[model samples]
Target: MPEMGRLPAGTMGLAFEEAIRRLELRNRLAALFERWGYLPAATPIVDFYDVYREWVNPQHVYRFTDREGDLVVLRSDATLFLARLLGLQLSEISQPLRLWYAEETISHIPSNHPVGDTGFQAGAEYIGLPQGEADWEVIILASEALECLGLQDYRIHLGSRALARVLIEAEGQTWSKDLIRDIHRLSGPCWENLSANLRHQFQCIGEPDQIAQQLGPFASCPEAAFLLQSCDILRSAGLGERLVIDLNEVGLLSYYTGLVFKIYVPGYHEAVVSGGRYDGLLKKFGIEAPSVGFSLQQGLIEVLHGSPEPQAPPAAASGTSWLERLANARRRRAKGERVVL
Candidate 1:
């Protein structure tokens, strides 16, 4: 055999069964969205680097200069692309046009290991949607997507960009950036041990100093009373239990004007589902519409909770890839179901 081998970028070349399961997940989600009037669309894996950089990060993208001396590269995330396309191409599609898609995304993972990560994502953007309805739709879609993936034992952790900003402003300061970064790193349990005041502020009870040591400058947002009042408005319109408000929680996406959420599963370290409202993005493409959306981190979820998919015998590979067929077949045989490849 060759000393070592490397797969091509932008693809893993999966076999049929694994592809089927993924396609099933995508199809189910698309169908659900379609039933709600959200139309499905496709996006490219490459685009002008300027837009990507101005939107996400300038350096993280796999960038290069084209023959025309324009910066362009593989698009790591298609959210911006979709937004741009809709603003330019579908301006006549009526207000609040619902768009959903499942696609591969490339993004720079800025963490301890500093990885360049690529994975699958399914998301929907509601054009011209109002804050109240848009927020509710995103939360419901997130939960529904989990159900589509054959997963349970997860809860939607909700917060509002509007709420977090209000709390940060209420803390009697400009809100230190360093402090903001610190608070984000603390895990749940560690946030539970501090003094009652701090605990209430953190919305958790953990070693404050220890937690701070890990996550950084922390601010308190015990203004749940205020959030409850606002939440009442949403509840009056009917979506209280599906939503949770912790005045203390802050989010990373700067464009979020209101309402943000993360879906957590028992085993995954990162949020398996994440999204929020970005009312300002439409203006970036030179039109005016409020937008809200979220994407499912399918691959990471599978990595944490899914076994290596099975593959099949060689001859049957003619029709299509059966990467996980063998693995699934053996599992069935182990359970005394005879299958021949």
Candidate 2:
């Protein structure tokens, strides 16, 4: 039998100092999001499994029968839940909604990494904005968030789903999940069979201007044109050196209809942040609007940055009597100095 107090394989328990640091980090991120005009949004931790049945893989989520005999699941994806919620209230809310959330999502899949199934995500969603404007805003926000965490050595791998489709169609090949996966892997037999030009296109990864010059023939296509335009926008905003244009780096989600990106810091195997523009996702809930967002894994961030320095407790109030000490403590607290009696 397992030890009495043992936690599950993919779960985590934080000690006092680490827990305090986590709270501090969450508050700092919340303040950053608020300063950017993103209001906090939350959803139920559990929902009917049917809601996400079509979008997520069964092996990736945790589900069980509820007290009422209905299949329910612990929330696996914050964006999906937020999209479903916003879709139901689209008529009730104003356009260009900016919402942020900090929550923990649990998954069934086990992982060897320190950041496992129960991941804490801090993210923001921009709803009802067109492609270029919305994508630019979210990408800049993501970059700023990394800077807030003191992560200077990071690269944002940018790509476009539409551009991927265009490239595949241009080569007289049908766009399928398998082909996209193979291209992303970049070393499979399917990748080897690809034409030299297409393989070169997938291999092209560099700064925006370099990529634009390299793929001059494909630049005229609408998808590639828009991607380069967005690149120019980011370059103008002083994020040129931080970008890596990878045409094969399409997002993991099928809902992504346009720009997709992942932020990677040096020495980390997994992306610290990932998201994209998913224009068609909200439509599934009967709302028609474009949405873009990104989520950062807080656990991975804590590991990267290390625990913050712990604050020293305030000195205890001195008094002869218990009542006097209590009064002194209250006075110090009122003056904004934390005191113990």
Scored by lDDT, the top model is: 2
Give each prediction's root-mean-square deviation over alpha carbons.
8.9, 2.1
Candidate 2: RMSD over Cα atoms?
2.1
Which 10-residue span in candidate 1 carries the lowest summed lDDT?
205-214
**How well does each candidate superpose onto the true structure, as a TM-score?**
0.72, 0.92
lDDT tens per residue, model 1, 64-103: 7888999787767667778877767765435667888888
Task: Estimate candidate 1's alpha-carbon lDDT, on a 0 to 1 scale.
Answer: 0.63
The whole-model lDDT of each prediction reads 0.63, 0.85
C-alpha lDDT of residue 138 in model 2? 95
Measured with C-alpha atoms, the lDDT of residue 169 in candidate 2 is 82
Model 1 TM-score on a 0 to 1 scale: 0.72
- In the range 103-216, model 2's lDDT, one tens digit per residue, is 999887556555578888889999888798889999999999888877888998889888988877877887766676788788766677778888888878887778777777
